[model samples]
Target chain A: MSALLAIEGLRAGYGETEVLRGLDLVVNAGEIVTVLGSNGVGKSTLNRTLSGVLRARAGAIRFDGAPIERESCAAIVACGLIHVPEGRRVFPNLSVRENLDLGSYARGKPRRAQNRERVFSIFPRLRERASQYAGTLSGGEQQMLAIGRGLMAEPKLLILDEPSLGLSPLLVEELFGLIKRIHADGVSVLLVEQNVVQSLEVADRAYILAEGQFAMSGPAGQIAADPELKRTYLGL
Target chain B: MLSPVILIPVLLNGLMTGAVYALIALGLTLIYGVLHIINFAHGAMLTAAMFACYFAFKTLGIDPYLSLFVLAPVFFALGYVLQRFVIGPASHGEDRNMLLVTLGLAVVIENALLVNFRGDTRTIDVPYAFATINLGFTFLAVPRLVGFVAVFVVAIALWLIMSLTDTGRAIRAVAKEKLGAQLQGIDVPHIYAVTFGLGTACVAIAACLLMPSYYVNPGAGNAFVLVAFTIVVLGGMGSVPGALIGGLTIGVVESLCSLFLGDSLGQVGIFLIFIAVLLVRPQGLFGAKA
Candidate 1:
């Protein structure tokens, strides 16, 4: 399958600290590709670079066959490469509806009403609290709102950074299930998560990032069966 | 009927003053809302616009308010370019830097006015400046009434622009969350400049409106600046509605103070209110919920 996104030899850093070093990755169309990593291992950094929040020091970011490494973050979003950032960065002061409305500020204004309906269908709780401030949401609900806002953009390739972070085990399972359902709808996903086992179960392909480089990558089942991953990441 | 001879005119003048105060505060609050910067130079921009209008009238003999159509866009472009090149560069991710830059701009403008115009207060002598509408009970100065109405219209228009237009939505988005708005393809720098322009445009409106009623001088800007700051704080920093309410509140308070005490102590009383309100509600009247 043709790749929706291809990052080759991607290197990026903040000031004196290099966070990503020669990281090669790919997300194919209609596929769920999870990047598994421990905390502070540059997985989030990869997402930021891909989403144009951080310019790559040296690398090629090919999104739908276009070089996008030097593009501004706003330009990147206009191209439909939506990144649902870590920590559920919802506009705390805005109402739930306004937050979702702003998501379509890039490329989906024409379909804002339609997308709002679609998002509400995906997360009914957001609809119920549409007028309420996003800051007051429960953690899980805020995560849902963040993901819902991302979906409002109608992304070509959704990069979910730490989607399951700070969620209860049950909510984590539900989030994973929802992601799988999103994948079933033929939307490509680049899932970054520390929940290695759950991510592996849902993702079609998996890459293990350690120290800003890909240590191992293959079919999900192989990454899951590898004895080293469990011992190193899971303390098995 | 009976009271305006004794009290009605004073009340009317108070409301008119409140209206003008609200207009000035609205500009200040808009800048604060989007940029999180207290624009120390906002009053100077207003005074600058007043001078621009003054020249437009003195040279071309055009009515001051009529010249607003031309003057507003001129000031908007001026503000946009100023924010883009000068203020934008200085505001680099630090609030203190922004504050200092605007304060410097204020000083520069004030001094420029001093050099050219001297410290003399100049007034726009429109034929109607002396016209008064005689109600049954008292006489209402036509210029003050017009200023009051203009302030009301401008306030409503600004609120609508922020609520309805595409650019307005982008601004409100930026105001609420900068990064999140940027993620949605809102050109942040452009938005910032546009916001500054819009804020400054309010000054143009106020300056045009104030021309007939007030005197213009180098330090005249300082009067509105102090009152504008108080209004912004009183209304709630960056809160548009708060600016409006706060302006009206201060206007009425000042009027009452002037009525009961005198014009000299009116300002002192208003300052007292500012202190008491800040002590009670640190966030001001319409500030964001902490």
Candidate 2:
């Protein structure tokens, strides 16, 4: 399959502290690829770079055969590469419905009403609280809202950064299950997380990030069965 | 016993003055609410708007009210470009950079005007500046009454736009949470410019409305600016409804104080209320309970 997003020697950072140093990552079309890493391992930096919040220094990022190195955050989003950032950045004071409306702001205004219905179907709890302030949502509900918002853009590839962070074990299972369902629907996803076992369980392919670059990457089942992964990440 | 004849004009005057105060306060509160910066230049912008009206009226001979048709959009465009190009980039982050920048702009505008116009206080001398409506109980000054109607109409229109429009939703989203709005693909710089434009447009409208009622001078905006700050603090910063309630409340109270104590003491009296509101409920009367 052709790569939906290809990052080659991606170097980026905030100020002088370089977080992503010569990183090479890929998300192929019609696949779920997880970038597994520990805290501060530059997984979020990678996500932010792709999302255009931080510009890449001395690297190339091609989305669907188009070089997007110079595109703005809004312009990148308009190209259908949606990023659902960590900590559930829902517009807190706005109503749940309004937050969802903002998701389609860049690319999908005409189908906003229709896509909102689609999101409501995927997360019924969001519909019940449509008029309520998004800040009042539980951690899990906010995660759902964040993903639902990503879907509202009708994205070609959805990059989710630490979706399972701060969620309960059961909620994590539910969230991973939702991710699997979304992947099954032919949407490409770059799932970045620390939940190695659970993420590898559902992901089509997995990249193990140590330091600022990929240490290992392969089919999910193979990565799950890797002896070092068991000893290092899973502590089995 | 005071008959209805005596009581009606007092009530009319209070409502009319209250309306003008509310209009000016809306602009001040809007800037305070979304930008999280006290735009000291706001009153200066109001003065600028008055100047725009003067040029439109005196040079072109358009009536002061009719000049709003010309001046409002011009000021709106001016506000948008100014906020976007000059203020937005320099005012990023948690620092008080935006406040200082606007304050500096205000000082510059005030001094520039002082040099150009001298210290003479000028009022728009339109035919209707002297007209009055006989309201049976009290004779309502035509200009003040017009100002009252204009305030409510503009306030309601703005409220509707903010509540209902897509652009308005983007603005509300930004005001509520900047980072979240950014992730949602809201171009925050664009939103900031639009918010400033909307806020400044309100000032433009107020300048036009005030032309027929108050004297126009470089220092004139200082008086309304004081009252506008009081209203924003009292109404809760960033709350539109709070602006209206806070403004009208300040207007009536200030008028009543003027009646009882004298003109200068009225402002001193209102400052006490600001202090009391800050002490008791710093969130302001109608602000969202955070």
| TM-scores of all candidate predictions against the true structure | 0.95, 0.96
Tens-digit lDDT track of model 2 for B1-290: 45756555655676678777788889878877788888888889998889878777778888878887778788889889888988876777542787888888899989999999998888767889889987655677898888889899999889898878878888888876776677667898898899889888888998888898777888888888888888888998888888888877887787767766778787776798999999999989988766
Error of 1 at B114 (Å): 2.5
Q: Give the Å error, residue A177, model 2.
A: 1.6
| Chain B TM, cand. 2 | 0.94
Off-target runs (Cα >4 Å) in candidate 2 are A231-236, B1-8, B92-95, B288-290
User: Model 1 residue B186 lDDT?
Assistant: 75
RMSD in Å for model 2: 1.9
Candidate 2: TM-score of chain A is: 0.97
Write candidate 1's Cα lDDT for A1-236 as tens digits: 99899989999989999989898888899999999989888988898888887789998999998999999988899888999988878888778997888788887889999999988988899999999999999999999998988988889988898989999999998999899887787679999999988999999999998888888899999989999887656546
User: What TM-score is obtained for chain B in each of the predicted models?
Assistant: 0.96, 0.94
Number of the top-ranking candidate, with TM-score as the measure: 2
